[model samples]
Every structure is written in C-alpha cells, then in structure tokens.
Target: MGKKKASSHKFLALAAAAAIAVPAVSPAAVSAKEHSFKDVPARYTEAVAYLTNNGITKGLSPSQFGTNVSISRVDAAIQLAAALGIDPQGTYKNAGFKDVPKRGQWAVNALAEKGIISGKAAGLFGAYDAITRNETARLISLAYKLTIDETVKKTPFTDVNAQWAKYVDALVKSGVTEGKTSSRFGADDHLQRGEWALFLYRLAHPAAKELDLTIMHTNDTHAHIENAARKVTAIKEVRKAKPNNVLLDAGDVFSGTLYFNEYLGQADLNFMNLVGYDAMTFGNHEFDLGTKPLANFIAKAKFPFVSANVNFTSDENIKGLVTGGIAAAPKDGSVYDAIIKEVDGEKVGIFGLTTAETVDISSPGAGVMFEDYLEKSKKTVASLEKQGVNKIIALTHIGFKDGGGDNDVTLAKEVEGIDIIVGGHSHDLLKEPVLDTTGKEPTVIVQANEYNKYLGTLDVKFDKNGKVIGHAGKLIEIDAKGEDGTYILEDDPEAAEILATEYKPAIDAKKKTVVGKTAVALNGERADVRTKETNLGNLITDGMLEKAKTINKEAVIAVQNGGGIRASINEGDITLDEVLTVMPFGNALAIMNLTGAEIRAALENSVKEVPGQFGGFLQVSGLKFTYDSSKPVGERVKTVEVKKENGYVPLVDTESYVVATNTFTAKGGDGYSTFGKAYEEGRVSEPGFVDWEMFRDYIQANPNAAPELENRITDINQP
Candidate 1:
C-alpha cells in the first residue's frame, strides 16, 4: 500500500507538471549540467540550461551562474523583456517610471512601453529587493499572455488574501499551481525549487493544438465550481476524440460562493490553472478584489486575455499589464471584425463583444465601461473584411435576445457580415447551432450550456474565400459517463501520507450529508420554461402568492418571469443541491397593490405569444386567463377570474387587490410595460423569504398538489 501510494504521488506531480502547455524545448540541443556554471546552485541547473538555450537569460560570468542570489527589480525586468524578445534599444521617453537610469534602461523601458511593469513608486524602481515567488509568477504570466483553464477541482487556501486574489485566480486558470492539499494552497508561502522549475517549463512550452478547435467558454464563474470536475473530464474527452479543440473562459471567475467568501479567489484560481485553458476575455468581476490583485492574476494566467473594448488610459498599474499588444478591430461589415487565426492555411478573423448591460450590473469599482457592442462589432467587422479576411467568429457576452420585447438578436444579427457567433450571457443552453438565413450568406450562431455543465462543439468547413462550406455542432453534456474519477489534488507527499493515515475518517466525514429532499424533480429546462408553462412554474408562482399573503391577506395574484425558474423538479426525493440549482439566483419577493382593471391590462399584455420569442409571458397562480392566437394583439386576453377564499370570483373592474411577483417583473422585464405603470402603494409585512424556500415549504405543506391548466385568463372573440 505504501509503494502504491508513493507511486500515485509521483504520478500526480509529474502529470501536473507535464499537463502544463508551455512552449517545448528540444531535448537534443542542451542538457542541464552543461549550463551549470561554478557558482550556480545544483537546483537551478535545469532552469539555467533551459533559459540559456532559449536565449532568455545569460549567465553572470563564464564560470558562475547566480542561482541563489536574489533578482533585483531592474534586472528582473531586463531578463523578462529579453525572454519575450523585446528589443533592448528603443525609445524610452513614454515608459512612465521616473527613476529608470538612462544607461542599461532599455529593458525596463521596453517592458513598460509594452505595459508589463510598474515602479515601486512614481519614479523609483526598487531594483535591489529580491523578487518573491508570487511576483515572479505574475511577471512571467504577463510576458507570455497566459490564461488559466476553467476545469481543475477547487481547494481552499490560506494566506492569499483579497489583495493577491486575482493572481491566484490566474495561476489556477493557467494550470500553474494546485493547493498544498485538497483543502489548502498556502499561496503566500514561498514556492519550492521543483515548483519554480515546473513553472518555467510551462512558460517556455505552451500547449499545442492537436486538431481543429472547439472552445467551450464561460465568464463570471463567481466561485461556482460544482460542475468543474465534470467540465474538465468532458473537455479532455472532447480533446482526445477531436484533437484540434480548445477550451476557453472569459473573466469574472472569482467571488460568489462560500468557497470564494472563505479564501477569496485563490483556491479557485489554483484549480483553474491545473485544468488548462486556451484564452479568456476580461469581465468586470476580476476587479472585485481590486487593481493589484487583478494585476497579479494577469501575471499568473497561462492563456491570453483579449479585451479590445476596455481602455485602461492613464493608470500606471493597468497600463503596465495592458501594454503587450492591442488586439486589432474586426474588418468592416464582417462578423468577427478583426479575429486572427490560421485555419487550414486560411486566415480566420475573430473579435469579441461584451454586453452593454455590464455597465449597469458590474461593480462600480471595476473602473471600466463597456463600449457599444453593436457599433464596435459593426466597425470591426467591416475593417476585417477590408483587410482581406473572410472567416469571422465573434466571441460575445451579449445575450441572445434583448428581453425587452425587442427582436434584436444581438450584434451578430444586427450586423450583416459575421460568419459565426460564439455567445455568452443569458446562459442559454443552445442545443444546436442556429443559422441566420437573412443574409446573402448564412451566419451560424451557437452557445454552450452555462455553469460548465456542457461544452459546445461547432464544426465549420470554410472555403478559400472564407465562405462557409458546411457547419454542424451540438452541446455535449458532461455527466458521470465522461468522468475518470482520477485526480491529483495535492503536492506534498508527507501530507498525502497523513491524509492516507486518516483516509477512512475523511471518507466517513464526506459521506453524503443530506441537506434537504425533494418529493419531485423540479424542471427548469430553458426550453420548457421559455416555450411553455410547466408544473414547476405553477408550483413556484403559488409559492410567491402564498408568501405574499402571509404579510397581506389581500395578496391574490402571483406572477413570475419564466427565466427565474431555472430547473425542473422530477418526481422523487430532491436534495438541497437540487433546490439551489432550481433557484440559483438569490431573488427577493416583492408585493404590490393594483386595481382589477390594471391587473387585467397587465395580464393581457403578458399573454401575447409570438413564435421564436423567449421570455415574453408571465406564469401565474391564483388567476386563470386564456388568449387566442387568431385574435389581434390588443384584444387577445378575453376572460379573467380570481380564486377567492370562498371560491372563484370574476375579477371586478373597480376592486383593488394585492399582487405578488419577483423584483424582475416589478421592474418590467420581458416587455411587460404595463407592469411598469402599475403602482406600488404599500409595503408588505415580510420581504426576505427566498422564492425556492417558499416553494419547498409549500411542497411540504401539501404533498398531493399538482399543476392544473385551468383557463383562468384567456384571449378574446376568436376563442
């Protein structure tokens, strides 16, 4: 058993190191012993050899390699700039730091010009201080444009506080470090010799593409790594089966869970680094921890972050991080505007679009504002087309439909020239790619299911002129069947030994702690909710009305946005996990008073069902209404009745009633403009009851309750 354990430890460490997608070094070119000079420590022999062979770092003396000596800030800058192939002689006037000396200052100036470093103070370069492991990790990450993958398992860590959180985020996403064990990363602790060596190896030899690429991406993970293990295994299987694929995620990866609240984002980052990602975009959530931490994460990522929309004007810290190269705008009248890639000997153009809504929802401290996606997309795509690139792909965070009763299908549809759209936001799990046939050429649009539950696989065959020859794709679900159940999770052998010592106790501690049970499986499938009202919707609406009346007896009508219902409750025992899944977003209950006439108008407005439209109608409880598709828009809703304590009563035009609904609807979501005019007269007694909690209580109180489609509200004369 000890031998097997030792073997497992060795295998895990080696696999973790090997999994790093750094640039490869030729084995036959040079060996470690040859690069070790007289004064160099034995441990740095490999690093020195690799660095020297690649012309990244030169030895201090013919017979001496300064391995143990600390790297000064100035020298560190020079060495890193050299490694990135920045010219030593260049204009240094605009580099920003005040104290950099005229002589031997080119490296610092070049790096600063490229936005890779900042001074200890305004003009002072603290050149003499020995660089820490964290600092080193950050600088190397920036030079190489490394982004962390979104797959690895999350573990808790101590010492990496809020200030250094983003660095931890990038490191994990880049596959740079896992925690010390399953529960701790010890981020502030000095990195070991073996760890540094592996870091350097990854820096030098990034991952290679074995086949065509299918990138599954997510942004704003917010510490929800519940499906991370499954996501990782699915990505690997996809990669193995179709060697030319990549997995990508945009930013906002930290802050939103008990885990993030516990360790900030350090543990989350560590796990992401272990999984490996190809690229990412910067979302505002990355700034939740602040600028320094954001910079640190930027430095530790193993993949490049693309942000053409955000401008980091005068801030020295942000400027230093963003100076690598500005991504070009997409060509005119084309989808991707300015994407760059080599696909089958053809140049494929790709640009990215973030939501305009991010300005309102993102934390204000992010210090950034989104540009208009439609305008940017339009201008960029036209430019890319003028540059002679035809195949375009837009990596967008803008939602599918503008939920405002607006038919705008994002910038992808508004603009005429995009070839493909890879989308995020609205978390819509597009089961198949939708092709827009309105244009002269078809535009293929696709999105994967959110929370990393599934990866979107898109296969597009393009001709010489960048025209699509064929396209096919699907959302591949990541389930138990795709997982191998083998994971490394730790680096310390002694800790592993101790964990082995108490393995049984730990296993027993983790034996499924039941939080709650469901009598039936709640269905929250997007299709079922957006297209038709389900049993789950009825149950949830009932909960809203019931909760509202507890505070005010007059609360009669309950309304909910279809989007708020996230999952379906299947018949059987439901776990707490299932409950959380059903109500992922923590929304609050709101009650309002409306006259019977106003209620009828709001009901009529919400029932206009249009084909191919999502999030239009309001699901209700305690009220029944019907509409006729054959009737005109204004005359759709015909009859309405409310369930009184005694029995059913025809809704009186003059009677005032209390109504219950979510805050989303209260603010007029899904184009229910009539709701915007409805006045909120009085505050209800209670306000903080969670919608799902109410649903659970309702289920417990009445076990035999099931949804009945009674035509309480309906369409006019046509029916």
Candidate 2:
C-alpha cells in the first residue's frame, strides 16, 4: 500500500502579534440534495453547496454561483478561512496594509497575522486583484498542512518555479489537483471560484482512502492443461490473500497440445471458467481454426472478451457478441472495446489489443478485420477517460519489445494514460514489473511467460487521482516441485476432477489410436534433424509436398525447417499423439513461387550454419543438394537439382519452381529471409492443411512407408 502523506492540518494561531486560534467545529453531514444554483455544473454541484451550507459563500445573488468567475485575493482569503472552520468575525489586529478593504478586513487580517498570507507589496495587500493559481496552492498547502515531499526535485509540470514547486507538488501528491494538464501547471493563471471550492471540499473531505489493487494475470496458456489444477490452486491462494483481486488472461488459449486437436478449445475453456477469468483478449493462435470454433468458445465463456482493435463485424458467427465502444455495464459471453468495473468502490477500465500480424500468422478469415493497434489504443484510452474512469488497464497480446511492429513496450512509451499493461505474445516472463516513467504517469508492464508455467501477480496502489504511486509484481511457478520431485502445491480438487474425469480419458484414448505403421524409428531427434538429413525430416517434407500438390498441382518441391519437427517417432505403430508431438505447432503447409536463384539463396540460408545445428536445415522431398562445409557460409551450396519426371536435373537459375514448406519457415521463422521475401511478395498460397494431418494422411495412405535418406542432402566434406 502507498503511504499517504498528511493532508489535514489545524489552523493554529498564536497570541500577541499572531492571529487568535479558533477551535474547529465538525460540520453536519450534508444530505444528498440538489442546490438552487442553476449555473453550477453537475460535477461541482455538491462541492459548491457544501461550501455554501457551511457559510463559506452566499453566491452572487441567490441563483448565480459565478462558478467560472476569477476569485479576488480578499474573497479567496475569507472563503479559505471560513472553510478551515475559523470564525471570520473574530477580532484581530490591523494587518498594516493601507488599501485593506472593510468587507473581508477581519478574515484577511486574521489570515495575514497567522502567517498564511503575505502582502503583494510593502504596503499594498492587492486585496481586489485576482489571486493566481500559485497563490491558491500555497494557501491550501499551508492551511491544510498537506505533506510536502522535500526530496522531489521536479514535477510533471515544467512551468512550476523553484519558489512554489514544493507547494504545487504537495497539492498534487495529496490528490488535491493534477493540474490543468499533465505537463502544464498553469501556475500563473487566475483561479476560478468553482475550482477553489472543489479544492477546499477535497481538503475538508479527503478522498476515500487510496486504493490497493491486486491483479492475477496469465497469457499464452496454449492448451497446456496438465497443470491447470495447480494453477487453480495458485490463483485461489492469491485470491485468499488479496480478496480485492481480478483474474485476467492475455490470450492464446487455442492451440498447442492434443487437447485442442480432440476438443478444439472446450477442455481449456472448462478450466478457464472453473478458475474464473474476468476477461481475455484474442491471441493469434485463437484464430487458428477460423471463426466458427472461436464463436463457439466465446458463446460458452463465463466472462466477456476485450478487443479494441479487432472488428468482428463482417463475420456473422461472432459479430452479435460484439458491442463496440466503452461498456459501462458489460455482459458475459460478449465482446467490447472496453469495460468498466467497480473494484472495491473504485472504477477501473480495461481494454484489449490483438496483434495486426494475426492476418498473416493465423486464420482469422477475410471478414475478421484487425485495425492498427497503436491508433486504436489511443482512442480506447480517451474513451475510457471520458467515462470518468481514471484507473485503466490494457490487456494486450502484442509482444513486449518485439522489434517495432507492435508490442507492449512501445505502447507504454507512446500512450499517456494507461496505468497497467498485462501483456503476452512474446511470452516474456517479467519477474518484476517493468515501469515506464517516460510518460506523464507511470505504466507498469507485466507478462507471465507462456504455457501456464507461471501465474503473474501484480499489486498496485493508486492515489485518489488514479496515479500509480507504487507497484510490485512476481511470477508464481504453478508447477513448482519439492526436493523429492514431488509437487509443492496440492491440485485444486474440482479442477483436478474436471481434468481427470472430464477430458483425460478421451485424450488418453486419442494418444493410443494408431495413425500408421513404420518399419524403423523415424530420426527426428533434435540434434540429427537440425544438423543432418533425417528420415523423419524427409517424411515430413514429402508429406508437405504431397499435401501442397493436392491443392496446387504446380508445387514440385517441398522443404520443412528442422525446428518445426519437435519429436522422434518410435518403430512400428505411430499413434496420433506421436504425430502431434512431432509437429505440435499445427503449422499449415504453404506453397510459394520462387526462382531457381531464389531457391538457391534459400538453400544457402538452410545450410548457412552447416556442420552446426541450424533449425532452418532444409529437409527435402523431390530435390537434391550438394554442399561443402569447407566452403564459406553463403557459397556452401556446390550444386542444386530439381527432380523431373525421369530424373534429377541441374537447377536453372532463371526458372521458377513452386516450392512447399510449413508456414513458419515460409514466413521466416529461422532466418529464411529469402523465403520470407517470397511470402511478403504475395507469391505464397496457404492450402491450410495442418502439418500433422498431412503427415498422418501420407503415412496412412502408404501404411508401410519407411523413408530413408537417398543422399538428398550430401555434404561433400563428410567422409
């Protein structure tokens, strides 16, 4: 919790040369009633009446409050004195000012004697002159004894001078004011009567104590439900400790393990619902299977989703769930640009942003359009502010410092009013909160890595003005183990039952169902597949080629990046689980048009780190290549050949050949810049056949398929 500075001070006046002290009288609590002043704006009505009822002001005539009129120095002193519970009629010695007026003579003289006021000149009090904002700040600070932090060297306001910086800082720190804008104090500007009344009312009634909020967040869970029970326990523990907490997920709950393949996202959604997520944003992977599955998932969700930039208008499936603009009363199983929730009597605003890269990286279909993240974020913040919500959060799936395209770090630096960023996409495990003080107010960014490994917890304290004054964060290891290799935290029984009885049986059965039979062990081991030609790599690429040809018969050659092949297949029966494990990312096959020279450049990149493990190591089908490791990196490929109907022919530099590869590599996953260029040039077409399904079909069609290297990728330097 942020320690609040002392804002309440008694108006103590000494005897003799000093003004007489007055005992404070507690004013009666005012009922909720509208005042007769027609000119007072609704925001300041209560404050204006509170001062009026306390005998501070009778108003200009009966109906007019003169809310915007510049308050003069004498009038300001009288009001400040009466609002401080001082008797303005008390007798006091003359203040020794020649031009002192008779109307507020006693109040001004009493305040001057108390050392709270000083004359504008040696003999002139400037009693009739309009008091400046700087004067108001100093008077309020002294009268209320607002705690001033002397160590603060500078404030957000650049215009405040050395003489009055502390006073202005005191008022801001005490939540009395945030200035006219973030950077401008308007210190020399004249004070309005209504503004001073509001300030005095705040001093009289300090805001409902500073709010301390705790947020438990997760992101990129990606169907890793094995430890979902333990994650539930961790979340429960946090909620037990901090009841004033909210649970949020930053997105990507769709793909990764066999659970998704068998149940789509239902299994993950059950656990998410059980754990009670307050809101979630869509990650790129959420659109992997297109709109129908996503629509079904949202329909069954217990909480709403926030996506400020994703427009679901054209899509009929999920468009009805969307309610654009800020939602004051958000509904469950729906989508909104932003939502406001009252947390512990304080209103907090939350909005979401999905990456624009989703169009190329995932299958959102044509109807689901993604807007520019940065531009949408600015409008979202402004909209939230207009709703009178000062405490705001951005739950985002944009990566953290992911180049410059779209990420959390860039969002924090560019946007001004966002208080906290619960981020994902890059799967960054920020052990501590990253504070961006570059903006007017601080923005705290946190991410809990990926795959349900950790549950991130952030505790933040906001002042009355909704400025983040203090924050602390950490990632709780969901599957933390004891010394004996036993789990440290007990699984939540309900969650465990849901997983064991509800989903695990089908998953186990699916794991055992044989997809195909292989005579020998497919060598997809990390070291072999990444460094040398493996039969598993050859099989995968051949499957990719076969699948690509079914959609586009022009595809002649196929290449699979070694990194996309995750596991080895044992000899004999190949179960469905084995296929999923080997190609777990669910990368779709894409065919790209490439010139022979461009193919040669891609080949050069494929073996650039030859003799060492390169994930981009090309696994070939319908092609052969010879390279000498003794040669330089770019010039390693000695010769390339393309398979014709009869046999292999030397590759023609100027000729174009249709090539097939997983979307990851075709989109430049492992520095395949040549292939990436082809993809960027719109020469690539996605048949959308998932890698594992293609491999499974290819093996099923030829049950006894056992691929062996035919010296397809020969290293001339090898013995």
Candidate 3:
C-alpha cells in the first residue's frame, strides 16, 4: 500500500473580531411547522430563523432560550468545521494538549489550521475551555470570511468592562450583540444547542438546506433478539423522519444464551431477518458449535456473511455445510469467501474474519482454518476490485483495542483500501469511528457495546468517485422509554397465541422439574476448559467411569471432550431445563479396553494436531499423565498412571484397562485416531443410562459439591 499525498488545503482560523451585518428574516425561515424559535433572543433572530429553516437549530426551551451559554472548544470546532465544508475524518497533527487524545487532537489541529480560533498558547489548544458569545460570533465570522465596517463605534453597554472593549466594538458593528441589555458578555456561560445551530447557520448558509443520509446501526448483539427488535423500531421511526437511510450492524450478532444454544443460531437468524439486517459477520462465539453449524446458519440466513481470512475449505464438514447445492471436500477453497452487493446504487463489497484464537478455544469440529488477516484481506480487496467493487466494507468479528492482544488493530494498521470496518468480538463500545493509519483511503472503524442494549448509527457521504466525503456516527441506548414494542414477537397476537397454545406447557414443565443441585458453578466457557481442568467435564467423565466400572471393575479411565459440557451449574436448585441445556446432545456412553501403551498413544494423538490444544483430553476418575511436546510423538507421555480407589498406581504397559468416553471421541473426533485403532479390536458396550440422568444423580447425592480440578495434567518439552 502506498501513501497518498497530504491534503494541502490547510484549515484557517475564524476572524478574531465579529463582522458582517444582520439580514432581514425571510418567509422561508418560519414556514416549516417543525421550526419554532419563539424563545430566541432578538439579536440572534435572523440567525436563529435561518438555522430553523435549514433544520439545524431548534430552541431548547419554549419560553426561555439560553442564548448566553458558552461553547466548549471542541463543540465550537465541530460547528465551525461543518460550516467550512471540511471533511471531519482522519487524524490531524497534535496541537500540544497534554490531555487531548491523539485521535481527538486531529480535530483540534484541523480547527486551528482553519484559523477558527487560536489556542491559549503556542502549540497548545485548550479543547475543554468554554467559548463566549462574542468569541463564537468572531470565530464564525472569520470561518465565513465575513467583514464588518470599521467606521462603526462600540455600542453602549452598562457592563462593557475594559477587557472586552475592542471585541465589543466589532461585535456591535456586526449586529451580533444588539440584543445584549447589559455590559456583561456572559463569557463563562455554556453554549446551548440552539445557539450552536444559529451560529453555524449564520456562518455557513444564510439559507441552509436539509442534509442527506441517515444511518442506523447496532453492535455486540450477542443474540438478544427482543431488545434488538426495539432498537430496530426506533431506527425505523428515525428513518421515517429522514429522507435517506441505511441500517448497519457493528458485529457480535450471535452466541450468548439458551436460545442460541438450543436452536443452534436459528433464533438469531430469524430475529436478524425481522430486523432486516443488511449485512453481518462472525463474532468469536459464532464458532461455538464449530464450522458445520455455522455453515448451517449461513445457509438459512438471507443477509450476506462477510469475512476475508476465515478459510472454510480446510474443514470438510464446513465446506459441505456452507455450500448450498453439494457436499464438498475440505480442499474446496470457494466456500469461505465474501459477498458483494449494490445498495442504493453504491457498489459495496463486504468480507468477514474472526480471531485466530477461535481455532483452539471454540468447538472441536471447526475444521476451517484462519490465515493471516492482512494478507488475506489484501487478496480479498484485490478480488473485489477486479469485480468492480470500489467501496469496500469489512464485517470483522475482531474486537476493539483494549491495549490487549487485539487483532483488529493489526488489521487496521496493515490492511488498506477499506472504507469501513464494522467490528465485534471484544465487546468494546465505540460511539464514533476510529480512523486507521493504513493509507489515505480513510478507513472508518466502529463498534457498539455487548448485548442488544444499544444501536450504532453512522451517516456517510461519498463523492462521484465513491470516495468518502464525510460521516457522523453515534450509539443510541435501547431503554424502555418510547419503546413501542413493535419489533417484539410477544406483541403479535398470532405469535403469542402460538406460544401459549403450543410451547408454553412444555417450557413450564421443563422449568418446574428439579434435576439436581450444585454447590459451585461448573465450567462451560472455552477458555476455562481448553487451558485448564473443569468440574463439569470432571463430573461428566466421572459418571461415565462409574457406569463402566459397574460393568467391569477393571475399568480404570474415563475421558470426555470439554466441548460436550455446554453449560455450568450455578449455586441453585437445578431444574431439568438446566440439565438439558448443559447436556443437550444425547450422546451415549461407551466403554472399551485398551492397554496402558494404547492409552498413552491415544493421549499423544489428541495433542498432535496443535500441541497443548486439546480441550477434549479432559478426563476423570482413572488417568494421570504428563505430556512433553518437545519429545517424539510416541514418547511424549511420561509417568503414565491410573487412579485406584485408595491412591495412585503406576500404569502397567501390558495390562488391559477399561476406558470410558463419549461416542464422538470413541469413534475418533479431534484427531484422536489412536482411540479408533484401540476400539477396532476391543470390546465396546453402550450403557443404557442417559449421561444427563446419571449426572443429575451424582449432583443430587453430593449437594453443593463440585469436582476438584487439580493440576494433575502437565505439559512439557515444548521446543
């Protein structure tokens, strides 16, 4: 990527002295029913009327408008910059404010270059300081290059102290201070919203026109469908009030509750469809059930799933699921690409990507692979460019930079030719877009907070060449106030009747039945299990081992994949519903006999694909071993031991021991092919006992008790 030449049109400061004469109010100013400025001061009548006509300024109070309020330096800059027709995007050189953010300092510098107003000191801009009425008028006059008559003398003011003598004369000549009844200039007063509108209108357009483009968006949805519906309603109302509109999602649209888990993303897809989501991409949790389920979701979705680097071809299951017509093998690279659309006559290209950590921390069956995002993004952009896509958008499941190991920042810094990056995954809320330093192309990145609590809105403008001209974005909270519940499924009589007639009884029954109780919370999150032992996995495998022992006392080991334990048990009266959520899949327990050598081989094979990356290797009851990755494959297991009722016993190399695990791993999942080899000749038996039922019994017998997660599992020999 090559840097473009710097923009040469330096911003100039507004005039330090107020200038220009007030004009007569036109009929157009007061014709619109929405523009009522009865409380405006007499001196600002023309400016107020002009602003009201343009739809920029509306009085804050019906009877008493605060015209003497001071304006913050940043607010003043925003107003004056909009008046001057400058692009309010990109980074500017720092104006030497010790507290101003690096990103924020750009706006300050841009205001300074335009000579809107000088800072308190050289290289220092006190952005937080207030702007007085006279100061604002002068800045506005300078920004508009307005000139007042020099022959006019200072107007009479009872409180025109010595300090503002020169400014008073200039303001009087410009007719900006004619309504002032006293000598006081109200220098410390905060500027009101109405005052800002009047000032900007007078400075920019004596006769303003309504602005085009109204954008609405949401972020960090996390599958909270009901609240998302409310946000959509609010956005629609705003859209009805505006001329042009676009709706967008920042990301994190799936994976956070029983609804997502139970239906495997069907609920989220249905809700997003109701909200009319223009586009979305994967969040980290979107991979919770792995590639196959994710592809199933994409198949059902109407909107485009965008990502650049997530390659689905590496996993055969994912390839079959994402492709609509046929089941393809893992080698087909076409499944994991991007979607292009033409919205409102603008050629838009969207791509998606998730964090690389998802490969290890998510579900075991996510056979897809993640490549270097920047490299893959470049390829995607080039391909889109070849397809005549000039406006590119990245729907990223990456997250905001929290000074942590964030890949989104890396993507922003390395990737170029992107117009906007709608990001999620970290759950950080960004009210406005962050300009990346990738190139002069101006990439705007934004994200909303987690859950369906807020909606992000962005209004962007483009030139004839499809280059971004301007944009404004904000986050709107979805509180109950003015929430009409139009988007709610409960509001629909038919839907409510269906729920009452069909699903309500089943839901009530599931909730009422007590399954068991737990003294402590069980582990369910991927981070908890992939990197460490979990009580839930322990209890589950313990049940399997116990069941196997009943059939054969020789059973010495039990292992289950951490991914199978979907939910944690909090301290409470456990219900059947909770148990079902935890162990949703009805996987039968299987027992098999394997020698100590074969057991060690199975463990080695579990860690082979990505060493120390097996969440499925979690075991309970009998089994203890230290694995060193630096050693050769067959020699990695050291000090292999089995648990007896009394204590630990050394594993005999030739002695046959019964092992128990779920059918998934027994048949070979997570590359545990060594277990498959052992099962080929060993006797296998399926116990009729339901795994969840046994788990409930175990928890009931040991109330408030959780399995002890000792650091018995160790990793070694990493080169």
Model 3 scores what on Cα lDDT? 0.57
For candidate 3, the TM-score is 0.43
lDDT of each: 0.56, 0.81, 0.57
> TM-score of every model?
0.45, 0.60, 0.43
Best by lDDT: 2
User: Judged by lDDT relative to the true structure, which candidate is superior, 1 or 3?
Assistant: 3
Model 2, 1-719: lDDT tens digits are 12221121211111111122222211222222333666789879867866665556656644567789898998888777766545556788788888766767777788888788889888899988999998888888877666777776677898888888889999998777999999999999999988988887776555544689999999888788989999999999999999888899999888767788888999999988888888899988889889999999999999899999999999989998886666545678899887776677566788999988678667899999999987898888766664346778999988665532688877898887789999987666689999988766889999997778999999999887788999999899998899999999899999999999999998998888998999989999998888788999888888888877765677789999888899998899999988988987766666788999999999898888878998888899989999998898899999899988899999999999999887667777798888778765656654445678789889999897788888899999998
- Backbone clashes, each candidate: 84, 0, 27
Give me the runs in candidate 1 sitting further than 4 Å from their true place: 1-213, 218-222, 250-256, 263-268, 283-297, 314-319, 324-339, 343-346, 382-388, 404-408, 480-719
lDDT of 1 by residue, 1-719 (tens): 00000110111111111111112122232333455477546555555765565454555555555555555666566556555545555466566666655443777776666666767777776665555655665666566555633342332555455555555567665665665675566654544433444466455433322224455555446555555555556666666776545465645565544455444555455556656665555544555455556666656765455555555554445656563222332221111113355433234556665555444334424455556666666666655554344566776655444331111254544676677777654445578787876655667877764444566788776544455667788776654342466433212343234334433243333323333344555566777666455677777888788877775677898987777777776676554456667777745455666778878788666656633336656678888776665677677666778888897788898988888886556645677555555522212211324466577667767665555545443334332
On TM-score, the leading prediction is: 2
Where is the poorest 10-residue window by lDDT in model 3? 10-19
How would you encode candidate 3's per-residue C-alpha lDDT over 1-719 as one tens digit per residue? 56332122111112111112211122232332354445566667755654444332234444333455555676566545433434445455555656444434555666666565677776566676776665665665555444544453454664444454455565545444453456656544555655665555433322212234455666556555545445656666666776466565655455544445455667666656655666565665566556666767767766655555666666766565453211101112233355544344334566777666455435525456777777777777665554334566677765554211335666666776677777765555677777776676677787776566676766767554445668887776765454675433213343334435544454455555776777677776665555445677777777777766765577779887766777777776788778767776545456666777777777776555335445565555577677776787666667777888788888887988888876556656666776666544434443323456567667777776657776456676542
C-alpha RMSD by candidate, in order: 19.8, 16.9, 22.6
